[model samples]
Target: MDVQILFVDDALFMRRVIRTALNECGFENLLEAADGDEAIRIYRESRPGIVLLDITMPGKSGLDVLDEIMKIDPEAVVIMCSAIGQEKTIEQAVRKGASDYITKPFKSTNLAGIIKKYL
Candidate 1:
């Protein structure tokens, strides 16, 4: 696909897993950020079509990044990724303008499906 996607997570392993999954699904235009600051910087510079953001990170948390992205572009498609039992945080993220969310330990097919939904 031509659409660019931003994947933000503090864990290198998690980023790699997501990248591998998306790559298998034929999504080659992907970007990665280890923390929220970089994610925002890239979002500002690149304006990607979608963002797969981890809810908890070392700095500036995913929710904070989501807020800023929403401010930058209300129509931006941001899908939050969080660990299990973060329903409240997930709800808060949605309220802050996240397009959708996926829990951690997600299946590759499900992740690809969600991205395709926005596309």
Candidate 2:
């Protein structure tokens, strides 16, 4: 409940859906970013407890942001969320220190479960 979550996605609708899902789960301290740059800026300033990051965006892919965030704080919790479910991509994310990976079009309960796992 107290833990802050950052939702990084390029789509406004996706962000809204994620927010609504988490809100229903009683996660009120949520931050959002429409792109990688803004996500990085917000992450640096706020240092949220958990980050739900998307892989695709206009600039600076989610993997790039993940690398930067890891450099900033090795212990930071970052979960990758994207429609791309390629095995190689997931492996790369995990290798880069992602806490977990969630494929898009996921159920709200599943997302909540993942978030709760890390918290």
lDDT scores in order: 0.96, 0.93
For model 2, residues 51-105, the per-residue Cα lDDT tens digits are 9999888889999999999999999999999785566887899999999989988
Clashes of 1: 0
Extract clashing residue pairs from model 2: none
Output candidate 1 Cα RMSD: 0.5
Model 1 alpha-carbon drift over 4 Å, by segment: none
TM-score of each: 0.98, 0.96
lDDT string, candidate 1, 9-100, tens digits? 99999999999999999999999999999999999999999999999998799999999999999999999999999999999999999999
Candidate 2 positional error at 75, Å = 0.6
Cα RMSD of all models vs. native, in order, equals: 0.5, 0.9
Off by over 4 Å in 2: none
Clashing pairs in 1: none
